[model samples]
Target: MTTAQAKTFITLFLAMLLTSCMVADSTPDNQWRIVDEGAYAADVSADAQLSVVSGINNGIHVWRFGEAQPLFQWSHQSEGGDQSNNLVANVHISADSLFAVTADREAFAIWSLTSGEPIGFWRIDESSIRDVAVSDNGRGVLVGRSNGKVMFFEPESGRRIEFLGHQERINSVDITPNGRYALTGGNDYVAYLWNTDSGQVIHTFTHPSRVTLVALDDEGRYAFTADSQQKSQIWNVQTGEPISQLQYIARQKIFTDAVFSKDGKYLLTGAPSRRLYLWEVATGKQVGEWKVAPRENMSPPSAVVYGVGFIDDKHVLSVSSSGLAELWSMP
Candidate 1:
């Protein structure tokens, strides 16, 4: 990064600190539920029909909308200990909601959503797992590691392909629902859209700072990549061209989670300061904005939006670090 970019990043970081320190209720109106009190991590399926949450007290639990009881409950065994002591730091569910992955620092476990069974558990050899994603139908798993390596593994066939293009530790990763493509961002200030079959790069997206987050459209039409600084852009998945960069009044708007609309017309993003935004894909305009609630007894009065998905053309869903599942009307 250049000196100019470094100055811009510091300005943005201080702005975020000032905003987060404020006490206010920015939450918009919504129907909400307490899925898990003090959730450690959470994720929602692409269709918004299913959710998985891990709390401080228990293992991971998967819930179907409108159902009081969780559909499945599973736990990852902590290193040198039982499942009861595991603290899952990351959780991801497939777009089809057929599979989920839960991980800590050293290992990750894959689960089948339909039968509520543990499919497999794997431990990293020399590197720690940073993030993980499962392909629809449980055919593929993508694991980003702390040692600048990404693994594309097949559970049934026992095949593992490594993507070693990154020069620094990986930060985030996502896989296409069909398991054909992979997107990953890293501290190296670059994001790659690559073929999972051949381990080849199709497109490279560069940034001014470390790439913090990334996501892929379920239909493989678009890709979203954001850095720690001010740059957040969407790209054409087919043409490998830049589409539009998101516009914000702040020095920067850091996204913690993001998802593309099914029709590939809009993008939804969530941030640390209880912010949720809807952006027009073609024009890169801010068409809608909403905020999720912080925990009731929290000091800072802010929540990090962990997961977002479209319920339909008219509704949307979000899961937050606040341990609440909220349903919002489309704006």
Candidate 2:
């Protein structure tokens, strides 16, 4: 063959090989369904039985894993009975799946999972609500605000506890299944594990940049904290000591959501780049990894992994901003 023809052939082959690799990496080994076509946000219950999604219009829908239709549809409305103009930016289901919490920037509402009805709705007056968590059975509610305060409230008793440790906007928060302890992170570059009743800090985890994500193991075994920069560490909840740091080769690996295994042996984390990772709790080694598919005809061909949970010992599930729900076999 002529030299020019040989060069052209080599370039074409290289392009084909790159394209094939991209396709393979973006496709999951197993996908369950497209839970929501264009959901703004989504969250999965810790037991993996149900999922809650926020649609473009800020309406909320709850779906059982095997069901085709959502069990409930709800929307936040104004006092005049008109739909609120704000979009629902976050939705989380309780560990027991008995209730869920949805929050836009200015308000949050609790819903009953069984009856599919609103339990109560509350509005924030000072600053926007950045993140929220509901303990099992909806006995306790926690919200992190843009004004650096985290509030833990009981709907039945009208008791409230405000945490004023953070000096900057609160970014993430989680509570124990029993609603005893709370884990929170903030733009002040700190993660605090504190008491829900006293609001006294138990342990302070410092980071180099803003702490963007924090999670507590439902069993109270471990705590996971990550910053906007490169540092991510797992801590022993009882001893208040660092267990191990997530060892990612990337300079920065930002986690949008995380859940611990029931046995506390493994952790599942989701990232904004459609990346889901399974890590060993003791070693912090990445044992498994998967990439979720992007939205159809997306310009950048990327999706944010909104939530992840363990379906069972052998399988894990993830929901992405692309509105896709997938089940994956653990490695």
Candidate 3:
């Protein structure tokens, strides 16, 4: 071949190779870019802004999309005292406000999103708090403890109201959009629906496995639960009946968490094998799947996830054991 022709051929071949590499890496394995790293992120929520609570620093960090650095950070130590060792179980942002619970076993705090100043703090029971959910009206917050006790507090007044019933450590709690009902799950392999006004258990549903996570639909008609025994179930909020259940994909093994779309038409689950599954609510059909690659310093098997939240109808934010948090856009 002529020299000029040989040179052109090599250039074309290299270009194709590079394009192929880009396509391969562009798959689910690399689609998620790290939003935060180095700290053990416990909970994440988004409203007008994105918020993350890190157990390592016992701090709440806020990020506005398009900004290179966090807009601000609020830490437990800022409230005065040595709370560095406390683990933050959850962090939430609502109507420009932020709330977080410290792992010190009894305290929860509120903050102002705009100013990053501590607004108020309260102490619940002596048991470690496992989960927290803020009411839709932004007036109340529910705190779930390791002893299966749930406390409702008026954020402004710091008044505490107790709800009793579950016999094991409460793992998850979610309130309805109208602030009338709440669903809580725990180690007892059951979920209880409570009337917010009366603080009474109105209904209960049992699962074959430990219910690790729970989420209420935007309309308050349905409650979704993810269990450790490899399944996710949707319950009719009023009837206390499970209307549908999705078995875990056999190869994946562990089902970490589940969340419903804002419209309640779809459900999403995160698996231990670094896979995310999307299911149709009515038909119980698997609609989509995406895989997440383990971070560099993290081992695959031990990188189990415990948190998943919808960024919108078409995207989700997930956190893994390696403290890597990323946002995934859905298909």
- Judged by TM-score, which candidate is best? 2
User: When superposed on Cα atoms, how far off is each prediction in RMSD?
Assistant: 6.5, 4.5, 9.4
Candidate 1 displacement at residue 11 in angstroms: 21
Regions more than 4 Å wrong, model 3: 1-37, 46-49, 55-58, 94-104, 249-255, 271-273, 300-307, 311-314, 321-325
The all-Cα superposition gives candidate 3 an RMSD in Å to the true structure of 9.4
- How would you order the candidates by lDDT, starting with the best? 2, 1, 3
1 or 3: which has the higher lDDT? 1
Give the number of the best model, judged by lDDT.
2
Residue-level lDDT of model 3, residues 1-331, one tens digit each, is 9999999999999898777433121143222322444344445443323545453533555555334567666665434566654556465444223443333456777665556666667666488878777765466778888888888777666566788888889988887655667888889898888887788888887878778878777666778887776567787877887778764344324565666776778877766666667888886677767655564565433444545667676677666544555567777
Candidates sorted on TM-score, descending: 2, 1, 3
Question: Candidate 2, which ten residues in sequence have the lowest lDDT sum?
Answer: 20-29
Local accuracy of candidate 1 as per-residue lDDT tens digits, 238-272: 88798999987677678878998988898998888
Clashing pairs in 2: none
